[model samples]
Target: MGLYLPDAIRLHARERGTRAALSCADRTLGYAELHSRTNRLARALLTAARPGSRIGFLARTRTEAGEILIAAAKAGLVTVPLNWRLSEAELTALAQDAGLRVLLTEPEFRSAADAVHAALPGLRLVIIDSPAEQQDRQEQPDPPDSPDPSGPAQAADPAVPGYEAWLAAHPDDDPGRGGRADADEVYLQIYTSGTTGVPKGVLLTHTNFHAERAELEESRWQPGSVALNALPLFHIGGLGLLQMALSAGAHSLLLPDFTPEAAARTIEREGVTHTFLVPSVLHLLTELPGIERRDFSRLHLVSYGAAPITPALLRRSLSVLGCRFQGKYGLTEAGGTVTRLAPEDHRPGGPRSHLLGSVGRPRPGVRVVICDPGTGDPVPPGTVGEIRIASAHNTPGYWNRPQETTELYDARGLLCTGDGGYVDEDGYLFLTDRVKDMIVSGGENVYPTEVESALAEHPAVFEVAVVGVPDDLWGEAVTAVVVPRRDLPRPGEQELIDFVRQRIASYKKPRRVHFVGELPRNPAGKVLKRELRARLRQSHQ
Candidate 1:
């Protein structure tokens, strides 16, 4: 097999032409059909635009999404999958910033596509899955001179064309002239919602994917595995798992969207061997009514990340899923994971068990160290400091923010993760809390994660976020926002505070509690601490 992702797909298609390569809701594409369709779409793209051009897809995860991604790879164009949940203004901004030439969208987003087209004059819009006859009718000579009221005549179908029409117009024959792309050539530009500001695009190369696959293959994956795709494809969790599944020549059962019942049904029906998800979704699956009635025997492994998982959730998931539960720690800049808590280490014993709060040890081919936040000097083991990682999987830098890139990626190319954590004597990595999220209370420092973890252990607490709120006496007091478990009695604020206090030090317990229906989170399931902090500040004011 070749190194590039596209080459791998091509090889797989040649070897197993009739084998199913991708599946979505009620749809499956065999290797042959996928390859031929992708090739035709690639030719269409190449004929319409130059190589190395940027193409954006503003659509949900469907069978066509995977095809379009692979097609862009074959066409030598960089594919930018815009998060379908992004607002029109946000989508337009991203399209413009990326300088996308062609935008492929679904019919539901026709208005968004129009907005994008209006904002970006150069973008060509192609509607995927739109009726073929409608495209033809729209293309038919638009009533010779019908531009009396309108300043300029527009295509009846504002979308330039449909994906099928474009593919139909192109020949199936491979365009003999193949383009060369280096390992360092930009492969994907995934934007991360900045905790402090606007989202910034993180540029990842083919080499990054290859490196990640190589590392992952050493431990987690093998050929013929079945991976469940429930995470959003726009985030690292979903895309990273997708790459791993594809690299292994495995079957990926794609979920159009995440729903506990749907995920459990897919796992049972598809014999899903491996899956990645956020802890919130895992919680739902474990606590879903009549969950024991569902068959989880097919699930061999369940990996959760994107947020700190509570020990209760972890233990419950392990027992309920009846599989190995692995935790990975990484960010968008790291291209995904720098460390992973192995399935074996996930057992109940030794430092590994003690370090459940930790994100585990650095993966093979990666080096991690805790350094002084102010000086950037390496700190002694067991000391809480900034976590830094060095690996091939680490992104080179943010797309265009040179200053921020330099700040995070040091001269030695080590990425400063901005998270505070320490490595134990046994080499397990434990995260304390975000340096920015740490609370200074009356000359004492308290980590919100520690308190949040304690609160999560309570039976009635479904989800919780802890942030530092202004306090005249303590300077900053810990405040907890809790989403109670379904139909659970609402515990008094003092009772909740006492529960955490009994478990941890009194000072670390939340001084106040606010019951809410849901914890504010981004689309990726990460708690928006900035928003939490803002809400807490407003409460005091």
Candidate 2:
């Protein structure tokens, strides 16, 4: 009777009983089945976990990953989808920090999960989608009457994954009692990539989902269509797509990882209607050999973000897929997207063509303001500053970090997005650079993204990142890290510098260029500026 996520699944169960809700490995699960599975999972979770328990999910994209999110919500638990791509140290640190009651992961990440469990005495490891259960019973010793303080024996047996046991033991029903769901209660905790240091967990309530769902409900996606979720589930963008697909009662293809060939084949074979990918995925798609020979006629929407799409890439994508594209602007703290550039805004020769470089306008019930970083006042249109978001979908706060939360969300309810950007007169949001990436050279502010964008326009520049290095005369001098396109000849460093100088103010040009084989980026596709800075510092002197 409630409107929580599990309630929505149940709604779809009765509304579209036989429709495929999730598809994996030639097996399509109908809504009725999805509803039953989630209900059973929820009941199992409720039995073992206390209210407000933390359940950490560590796996590549899978149907169960999505299931765990809704299942945890139904049990009044917080689902922390851990990044499986992180190093062992990072993963263990995160597991310890979240203090999870249970860790659900895949056999692929078994070692990582084992390492995490070893570090946290109270942590239980549950490996899904493998022969883990059969071997689990054999490998784990019989439980001793005495509790082990340094092991999962304190709670559940930590040796083996109980994924199958949870399913077989529990009945497929809501338990006919109240669960942990309430309007303002936090439902999910997604950790921010600790690019700066230790990643902070962002706490999002059901209220945020309600707001996000309201906007998702406005999508042009048709009922009973198929969607592709190639982005990692640990990322907000991936989880957002899953939420949208489930709420719409649409069939979704959950991928463990994204490869251009697999994505192309999946789209054609599955008749995918919609998908959201980072620009890197799009780049991979275009670079694929014989891609044009393949079928993509079923594609309806191709939404790309996390980084800006170059004009060259955009044109190639338009010619390749011929589907509507959308660009969105958001961080994990904002719950995926508060502003989106719609398909209409991406049309060539359209009135908004000049603004095509911009990420797009604010989405429904969202307001974007360019605030001066120094004074916390709104900057005039076309003036660069910190981009702030006022939206119903913003996270309540970062978990366990009040000072960081206070800085993130100002007194006026605006979430100060660490991204630096400016709004045009037409209300489009153009990304400049991360506020942390801004360089001060002899009293002038130089944004790296502006210089990088100008460099991206060059034919030979496959990728470029600009960082500042210590300069006695200028305080800090702009430095360009270039990755030349494999198909083209490499350009000289000064030639690249001159290209930027001509495109923007000469002072903003990268004074020195360093050519590299590739630019370092996290899975989300954001350049590792801090790494670049460190490398420069080590090399200098």
Candidate 3:
């Protein structure tokens, strides 16, 4: 009987009926309209699927994406936001795993949706088109034999319904809590990045989200705040950011997809006060043409995470955006951020400036412990070990994976983060790297983030990923894959390696360096080191 997801919409609708709730492209929905539409969508979802069923959403960031989440919560269904960036095969695998009863997708992903439906005939498909697309379809009549473009898959399959039509058919009245789940029940099932292995669905309950909001620090919502939501909804950072904004009655400006230009334009035009961007996005923004001239006066805060951020990039972002920066450290299983690096800690030469390199202390109501990865025994402070966290925001477990779920926690019940890091004497959590990403070269342990951080300080190095490769004499050879800054003269491989050697221990330096145009990153801006390792191994073979 605690706070429900739909209750946020209902409360906002009653209190701020005429205020803008969500804006994307050329359309904006007021709180009242959003509440009413979600109610209808909830009833529609229930008509096609049953309560407790897994409802899937595979689309870009849009107002309809928010509608699906609120609707699923109201209909007592679990929302599984699928990554649209995934391939058809990957989508089919996740769809099968979730056993999704209904899938809400968009025209851009019609082929992928078709593939999923081909695999699961029982799965209902509903296409959600942008308002502009719908308007274009209404203006132009479809010609015979020509493939339908700028519209839903309704023409291809009679059974699959268009989202607007399906929603309009249902009553606008609130779908009473007859089928709603309790606060402890699963509300969102976000899949892991699967860098190490097969992606597992992390089951985050309603209480998990509520717990996250209660601990929000610098990113806390302010009244009448306009939030720019550019991250994809499939990622926890994206969905969680949207939820925080909506829950606080903040107007959200949704981006269909992230582009440096689009994000800059939206921030200036929309007068966005708060937003979240990954370090990679921030790098792009700082390097953008005429970026310094952009009117970021209204922008208040830029929260970033999901991957290791170099101090250089953080300083550059601070200089360019002229906004308070907050760093977050978290994963999907943690339901978002468990630690927040406050803006005050970001100062370069301040008394607590050394903490800038750390991910900061755990948020209120969260306890972080460093544990030996092998023995699961607590490690002393300042000793590198697996990061363990205990918090109300931690997911109950992974969906349908009891064995792995049980292993996710240690005997002490702290969720093992699988990240190698240590807490300093000042209580700051300094991340080294993913435990799996650690490189053991000639019996010396080398964390890639440490090497990458050092390499990133070089003027020529734009981005870098350090990994261990097969070696004859050594167990694994330390290798660095780098993307050099286009604006700066490219540094030689040995020169770049020597740059890191001067800063860190020589044994931790990269034995080999490979330059690339760009680093492969997942939707959440996390570098896909697994893919990079595989590529390097194949190339060596």
Candidate 4:
């Protein structure tokens, strides 16, 4: 039999049954306890619905949420984790598209559940949040709350029920009902941000996840490593990290939310060995007051990615954290991370450190190639082109999007990552920018990431985003949106322009600069260039 994620969890439970597996706030769960609870939950789910059903879960970073994910994995159910940040309308639409048989939510999203139920009548809504009084009355006999059984379940007015009471009566034994999951079995239905179009689900398999875990295990991870959990669970970064920690028998310290102060405290108190952050969060941690006073001696690895890191900021982080700072580059469709800069590469004052700006070489089992964007032919090492990846971790295709899947995946099954970049002679990947985000000024290609990286070097600039605005003569003019340092005096737009001009070509410098309090970002902490383009169009009109 092929190895699967659930099988790994079962093995860990047997080997380290009593060892602490997950810690969130003050609550802690051991491996055996987690596995048993997840098994019970899986049995309960099996009793309620058939295997291969799509189930929507709406909750924050709670221990119960983690339990549900593990249970879904064991039960052969496709779990669709909805972002709490999405609107009710978006949630309803996603549920309908996924053909969700069940809508599981906490009390915090009760009203949103009602909205979704109104739109999707066939969905069965189960509220997992039990009232305090209900917990107190667990000893007393209570009738299990069942859904409205009077009428045929329709697609518009869905049935609603409670989860605690249903699971209380079910025995904690394997249901032995789910079909065997093969290498190609769809394990998850994660949705991408609908920036380019309506959000479509991305199907990932057991093989894809296991392949990624194997790659990580072969690299730097070790057993019993304590990793801090701060990234949102809805995204691949957070979910994949959690899976890696579990597979390694590591302890995961979950942060209820992502705040620089909270993260610093957890690192000191829990002795967190590894953590991941984007450029924005790294800046927040380094810039926070009294950061130097914190104890980060226990920190071993700090992996950063999801955006480009400025050389100056990277240098500052190295000095401040005094830890092994690595970089990862990948996308959601590739099951989280495909390339990682090793810990040894982070040594200060070394040649490897000088390549800090690069995204590093591809990891094992991943092959990367650069091809001309227009001609689809291989490009030279130094020439900029579209980056493509062939890996076992890549998704089979976009769910229900055959046309898009065909365009994204070539006939040979290589995934065409919509990123523009080039590989150096030494095989290090240097990202120029996103293909859609590239600015054409006077027929010259100007990558926004290059300009943004240069602007981030300015002492007074706190954050920056580069985009192209419509111009009559140039067709599109380079524009920069900046967030200045809070304590520093606002620098003139011309000063900011001059800052980038000194580092790059004159055409690449921002022709227009706008100071803003913050830049629009998605759930993954990537700046939404589409939003910036929309704002520019509005201003021009």
Q: Give the alpha-carbon lDDT of every model.
A: 0.79, 0.80, 0.86, 0.80
**Residue pairs in steric clash, candidate 1?**
none
Provide the TM-score for each candidate, comma-separated: 0.93, 0.91, 0.95, 0.92
TM-score, prediction 1: 0.93
Write candidate 3's Cα lDDT for 148-219 as tens digits. Answer: 554434533558877887887899877664223467778789999887789999998787775234543447
Count clashing pairs, candidate 1.
0
C-alpha root-mean-square deviation, each candidate: 3.0, 3.7, 2.7, 3.7
Candidate 4 lDDT, 1-541, residue by residue in tens: 2236576668778989898888887778898888887788788777666788888888877676777777887888888888888998898888888888777887778778778877777677777744443465555565444477553322222244456665565667754322334567787888997666688898887766652454555445666689998987777877877777777778888885889999998998888988888888999999989998889998988889987788778888988998888788998788767777776666657866667778888987789889888878889999999888998888988878899889987656678888999998988898988888889999999999889889988989999999999999998999999999999999899998998889899989999999999989888888888998899889989
lDDT of 1 by residue, 32-116 (tens): 7877888898898886678778888877767677777778777767778888888889888888888888888887887787788
Better of 1 and 4 by lDDT: 4
In model 4, the clashing pairs are 121-154, 121-155, 121-156, 121-157, 122-155
Give the lowest summed-lDDT range of ten residues in model 1: 150-159
Number of backbone collisions per candidate: 0, 0, 0, 5
- Model 2 misplaced regions, further than 4 Å: 1-4, 130-161, 175-181, 210-214, 349-351
Residue pairs in clash, model 2 = none
